[model samples]
Structure formats: structure tokens, C-alpha cells
Target: MKRYGHGLVLGKFYPPHAGHHHLVRTAADRCERLTVLVCAASVESLSLEDRVAWMREVHPGVRVVGTVDDIPVDVNDPAVWDAHMAVFRAAVPGRVDAVFTSEAYGEELGRRFGAESVCVDPGRSVFPVSGTAVRKDPVGCWDFLEPPVRAALARRVVVLGAESTGTTTMAWALAEHYRRRGGVWARTRYVPEYGREFSEHKLTALRTLHPGASWEEVTFASKEFPLIARRQAQLEEEAARAGSPVVFCDTDAFATTIWHERYMGGLYPAAHEPRRQHLWLLTDHTGVGFEDDGLRDGEHLRPWMTGRFREELARTGRRTVELTGPHERRLATAVAAVDALIGEGWDLADPLPETP
Candidate 1:
């Protein structure tokens, strides 16, 4: 290993797997000062900012920088090497004393800068993974990815419906089902319904003060819905970051909008917009008895609320799959839908946009 004043590591780090980490960490150890350049192009799916953020988060010791480059990727033409060298020099801060890479071009790149080229693990013997493999099969390669990238690629299955529709129950069931599946390295995570948490807190407060209050009297302020929506998003993001390839959300922001309409008589702007999710598993109320807890309005409002949820879902135009039956049956239906989505090549790295 050759020591250097300033070392540089450059790559797309498209989904920055363990191999990239090995390369950078190895470089950082040998050099006094190391800089990692994450080069992204227009054709790449992951944004340049996101790639930079991941590198910064993972390797706080090394300087991480990102640039949008349209230069030829992996081109060996000598004529273009000068052009590429200019770009690489411009991308890095000052003079580079050493260039570290596992590619054939490492020697040439180093020579251009009058620096030593150190090639580590050219055979991929240390970290047996590639960005292409990670992109093609994220779940299969889940162990290779860093937490931030894994979280970003986690497939979200949002279970949604009106009150007493068993959204929470089903959400847990789906998560458990995936977790128990044998030989799968990637685990599942569940995001509980945040609105219900807020409502329970408010209900406890009301019962303490009022002593005898009807469900109708436990009304929510228009202002409170936005808070619930914000918390819901935060919880979902937190769960993803914690490293789960498949995340089951009890409900999402779109459902929060419906709840605002139910009590507040209007939409809460903060909760009005829908975020990207793979599938909306709408739970049906048929044959599912509506039992009122202290927070629920009653069985009478279930039908109307369910219809309103349907309307909002349709208006948003996301991929929808309705689950109706007993608990076991509902669970089976949901599992099959998610499996189908995966079988059809659902790329977690690049989420599909909401249907226009």
C-alpha cells in the first residue's frame, strides 16, 4: 500500500453498496486526506443530491462531493481521456496525490495527475457485490447495501381504509408474514397509524375533563390534522431508515386527508397531497363488524366514510388493490398482491410515479 498526501475515489455510487464502501474506506485509511466524488448523470435514476447525502452520512470522515457529469462512462478511447481528466480534476478540489480504483483505467487516471494509482480488490474478492446486482435485486442484495440506500429503496405497502376496517391489524400481519419467511435476509417494518395515536391522546384528555362525552363531542380541530399528517410522514421515513426492505404502513397522507374531511368538513392542505407508495391495500368493511371504541363515531358513519376514502383514492390515482374477507383471507389477498408487484419487476431504487 502506498501512502499519499491527498487520495481521491470517484464513481457513480449509484446505490453505493458494500463494495464501494470497501474501496473508499480502504483509500481513506492509506491517505492523510481523502475525497470521494459521486458522479451522477442525467440518465441516472437517483438524484445527485441524494447520492451525495448518502456518502456524507455513511463516511463523515472523508470529504464527499457530487457532480452531474455527461462524460462517457467507462470509455477507453485515448482522445476522450484528456476530456475526462479535465472533468475529474475540476470535480476534485485541488491537486490529487493518489487515485484509488479497482478498474483498468486507474493507472491512466493517476498518470494524468502525476500521482500513484492504487488498485484494491480488482477481482472483487473482498466485497462480492456490484451496483448493477443491487439495482436489479435490492432485496436479494439487501445485506450489501448501506442503511440509507436500503431505506430509500424499501418498498412501501400502505394499508388504508375507513374506521374499523382492520387496517392496523392487516398491516402487522403483512409485516409478520414477510419477517417469518425463511432464508430472507431483509426484514419487514410496520408504521402504525399516527392519527389514531393523536386521537387516543385527545380522547383520554376529554374523558378526564368532561367525564361523560359522546364520540361526536370528541371532535378534532382543523389545525390538528396537519400535525397528524406530519407525524405520519416522519414515522414512515424513520422506519425506512432503520433498514427494512419492505415497509407496511397502516395508512398514509391521503387517508389523513379523508379524516380531515370527515370531521373538519374540509380538506387540510398539509394532509391533502399523496406521497409515492407501491400499493394502496384498501380494506373492505363488509362482514367486518364495526365496534366503537371511545374514538370512533359509530357504525352508521362507516359506509359513508368508506365511500369517501374510495373517492379520495381514485382522485389521487395511485395503484389500488381492495382486500375483502375475514382476517386470514384479507392477509392472503394482500400478500399475493405485493408478491405480484415484485414479480412484475418493481424496482425499489426508482419508485414508480403516481398514476397521472
Candidate 2:
């Protein structure tokens, strides 16, 4: 088997760390020569010249080249990128055999063209990131990203709901409460759960009828669906492990499941008697303001549906905690509940005794 990459393995070796170092060392061992391409030179943000300088300092004899002035910097204007690459490759008479990359599509693109692409994975499973524990705070993206990309996610939280229901107002109040209590708040990004995006799509899209399909067919399809149904326990576990003292999840996963069935006509069991355990019913939405998200069937549907959300929760055989009262009262109630749980030493580790 005559493998072409006994020669150069190429990549944009940006700020080479343990991962990059691992990839380059592995590639260098397998191949006779390696061409680390410093692409996106003219595009700014850590110039190609600087990258080459860093690589030269570290890699010593390893060959690296800059394509700053050579290639079309405007990749967003995709029409010119391919043409630009061709001219750039032609212009750089300096040799290269393959494009060395870790990204999946990058490998495919290289294979399609004349060049070969190498997948130099860092074996992420073994050496979990040093930055991971920091990410649990739900604050800075520093925990989620490498240094360069970490700076991109500067954020602020906005809350929304009905006027007296205290959406934006509660947001500020909570921020203050968290600050005074010496608590690190997971800034809440809440909006009315009217689910506008889903609503708009439903207007034209044919609604899957309730009377039409058998339970088995719908249940089977939902089970086989690619996106895994995220369990509530998993979320709780993450919040705890992240060491976040108080997690303010907007409507929880149970709420999500109920809403899916209620609004979008999502899957629900035909027989309600054999109920799932460890669920909460939406009860006492007496003061809850009902707002229309354009595609809402009408105002009348709100009251009927509000009651049903709770009934369905009870049907699941899950314990119900009905959130009630005015804006200040409800917000205070929620805070009180979290404080009470923390006081009682609510161990999130305990699995919901039964599934809802």
C-alpha cells in the first residue's frame, strides 16, 4: 500500500498546545516531512506571521509557511474562496502533500480534492480538559473554550413574562438577592414559554392529528428519534457537580414534556391509569398571565390548557409543587423553595424515586 502522506502533513497550527503538540508529533513520526500551514493570514486576529514565529520557536526544524498575502481572506464570500485557494497553491511553489486536520468535514474536503487529509485526534477521552471544572459555574465561556475562542461569549441575562407576573423585574431582584447572599447566580435567560419558533412552524405545517395514529406507532417513533430525551435527573446532576449552589432553571424538563404533548400534539399514552412516577403537575396558574404567541389557537384555549398541564403532571404520578402568587410573591416563593431545599440538604444525586 503506497500511502501518499509519507511526505508533508499540513495544518493551521494555531497557538500549539498539548493537542496540537500531540498531533504534530504523531504526524512527524509517521511522515518524512510535515508542512504546518498558517492559513488565514490576511484575515486578522493573530496574524499568520505571528503563528509562523511561534511554531518556528517551538518546532525548531519543522517546516511552517504563511499564506497571509497569498490567499483570498474573504471566506464568507464563498464564491471567490475556491478560486483564491487554487491561485494561492499555484503561487506557493513550496511543496505540500496532504492537509492535516482533525475536523470531520476537513478530511472529506481534502479527500475530494487532490490532497489527502489526516485526522490527528488528541484522544480527548483520556486527558479531560484542565478547563472543565470552571465551565460548571455557567458563567464565563473560559471553561467551555480554548483561550482565543473563550473571549467570544461575553453575555447578559434577560427575563420575560406577563406584566404583573414579574419577568424583567424579577430578573433584577434575583440578581440582587444572589449578590447579597454571596451566591454565584447562574444568570437566568427567561422569556415567556409561548415557544414562538415552534408556533410559527405549526401554522403552515400539518398538525399530526390526535385521533389518527395508534399509540405504538407514535411511541416507537419518539423512542427511536435520534435526539435523546434528556432526563431531569441528568440536569440536576450537572448542576450539582458544577458546584452551582442554586440553579434557576426556567420551566424544567417536566414542563417541556407536558408542553410538547399539550401544544404540539406530542406523544402521550392513551391509558392514563398506569402512570409514571416522580412528576410534577402544573397547578394553580390562577394569577399566571396568558399571552398569545401569534399561532396560539385563541385566548379560550389558555385556561383549559393551563388546568390540563397540571392534570397531566398528576397523571404521571409525579409529586406536584404548584408555583403560585403575584410577581414578588412568586419570585420570593421560588427563592424560598430553593433555600428550603438547600437547608434540608436536598441531595440532587438521589434519582427521582420514579420516572414521571
Q: What C-alpha lDDT do the candidate models reach, one value each?
A: 0.82, 0.43
Residue 353, model 1, lDDT:
19
For 1-356, candidate 1 gives per-residue lDDT tens digits of 56888999998897898999999999999999999998877777888899999999999999999877776644566766776677777888598899999987789888988888999899999889887778788777888888788678877889998789899999998988887874542367899999989888887788899987666677778888888888888888888777467789999877888888778787576625447578899998888988777678657777888888777778878888888989988898999999987677635353321122
Runs off by more than 4 Å, candidate 1: 208-216, 271-274, 347-356
Q: Compute each candidate's TM-score over C-alphas.
A: 0.91, 0.35
Candidate 2 local accuracy as lDDT? 0.43
RMSD of each: 4.5, 18.7
Quote the lDDT for 267 in model 2.
Answer: 61
Which candidate leads in lDDT?
1
Q: What is the lDDT, from 0 to 100, of the residue 285 in candidate 1? A: 85
